[model samples]
Target: MTAPIVTRDEPVAGTPMLDARLVVDRGAFRLDLALRISAGEVVALLGPNGAGKTTALRTLAGLTPLHDGYVTLDGQDLDRPDLSRWTATERRPIGVVFQDYLLFPHLTALDNVAFGPRRHGLDRQRARAVASDWLGRMGLAEHARRKPRQLSGGQAQRVALARALAVNPALLLLDEPLAALDARTRLDTRAQLQRHLAAHPGATLLVTHDPLDALVLADRLVIVEQGRVVQEGDAATITAQPRTDYVARLVGLNLHRGRADGHTVRVNADFSLTSGDRHDGEVFVAYPPSAVALYPRRPDGSPRNVWPATITGIQRHGDNLRVQLGGPIDVVADITPAAAAHLHLGAGQPLWAAVKATETRVYPAAPGGSHPE
Candidate 1:
């Protein structure tokens, strides 16, 4: 059996890379998020648009001022509102790659990457030498002399990453680094990026909306909603138990809040679910969409959880079809194409959805939930 995943509030072992409470206020919106990353660890920051993801990144990069709290990197105070201390962006030991791979259009790939080392006080010849080595490591040595416009999208992204890494920064910030590539290019680049990220010894923070990127590239995930941290944990723990609607959808799980009594959980006034686990008080019930089985009519079986549902929508999910059902309790179920054909699935089609008690997982709703550090 797998042990339960612990919360992020406790201190992380080993040397700390970036540790700070980011507090930035913009009119009605306020971003109050505490973030910590250990050396050689990559943490992914995921959230919907307007969830303060960009604000948090900007604050860390020194592009935006903090309304409160402080920014500490490598045991140095970069920003502290109480002490009235601020570090200029260039003076900070940090590197950032923007969404567009903001490389200088006129500069060659080699020169573009060398720019960072030059800014950090490296001489021209030495900076170019370091840049050439990095470009070789990224498998772009052949495109060293090509201009940004001449390079492909994936090539440009690699050059941008090499530039950021050439500075040997204490903290590396990536803001939607792979958002601009096409599907096929993104796949190839994602693998390359993962290798480079693993090699980086500095603390890394990746801000992205793609779940696949977070799962593959990050050591831990921090999910934010409404300018606050909602959940933070490893990929396995997060996928197994989601605490909020946004997180549930992010991980492709059906989640519900309810009061648990032994094996049964009362989700609402009209609906209740039975789980294999026994827990008391307010709890969260979660299961994968694949766990839900749909039948054209009520089957003659002792299924512990069954409900009458109407198909609200249907969409292709990979090789299978994802059916959205709405009734007493809204849920999503994944069925093979053959099963869909057998059930004649369509929007507004009525059916029965059932889940075995053994498939459900329950956990506390609040005490184990995310809290501000």
Candidate 2:
């Protein structure tokens, strides 16, 4: 009998499951992102709307043509603009699950899952058997006869996933896989998707705008904006040190850019910072919303970074209230409702914001740091 596909880590020399140096142009938008994914690894491409996250994914899957650069999978060149080499989407060993879960409405779940294998030249009976096994693994065996229209959003998503996997792709691409589901269904579907991805031995690239999705489903995150990679690392590192305001907002941190002179950093001409650590160069200073303390008036104290600020807006964020304050620099502070009531904080209220020197962290800005809008 043929050996069962090994799911455990097996070193494959010079075998990066997915590698791309993609540069594509569309009118005014430009995407230049370099990405690499190893066998059994899941990487999430995250960014705001129109940030070229989807474009990058499509480029790798051979669905979108490259304006320049190349894509390689399992050491095979999929695209090389200079050499005039290009692989059609169907020829590339990649499977894509779209945001809408593009299943044939008339096809039964089993038939839908079997479609890929059949297209790949499997006999009808063999494809059906493989499809049945996949549906069984996904706990949808009882619903195999149900049409796509009869399935719930989550069930349809599972069917799409099964169809993609039945092809046994060398690289799996999921574009906003959980985006179309309701919150309740999304949570459940996300858990299921994670389990399946964990068991898949090939590289997976998930494209998402949701930070929660990236954190839970991916081994690493590649934050792209305007078609370029802004920051990339494991989840924890990205959360702690977000390089751009866009990333900071996604991860819920207050990010600032400034020029550092010893312990003091100047943010714009009007705002400056004094940190406990000394450095001399451009740097990024970041802190959580909770690190900021607001007062109705300038309190008489020895606080080093107290600045006069005005409440520009107030909104609820999760369990806490996020107060947007504007001064020499913009900042966000999270406070309890009681604190808001105690301080009589409201939109247009003048206040003082303070951050201890020790609470601020400074790090060298990455090359081509947060892009200018």
Candidate maximizing TM-score: 2
What's the TM-score of each model vs. the native?
Answer: 0.93, 0.94
Clashes of each: 0, 0
Cα lDDT, model 2, residue 224: 89
- lDDT against the true structure, each candidate: 0.90, 0.88
User: Per-residue lDDT of 133-252 in model 1, one digit per residue for the tens?
Assistant: 999999999999999999999999999999999888778999999999999999999999999999987889999989899999999999988789989999998888788888899889
Q: Which ten residues in a row have the lowest lDDT in candidate 2?
A: 1-10
Residue 268 in candidate 2, Cα distance off native in Å: 1.5
- lDDT per residue, candidate 2, 48-130, as tens digits? 99999888888888888999989988777899999999888877777889999899988999999998888777778988999
Question: What's model 2's lDDT at 233?
Answer: 88
Question: So what's the TM-score on candidate 1?
Answer: 0.93
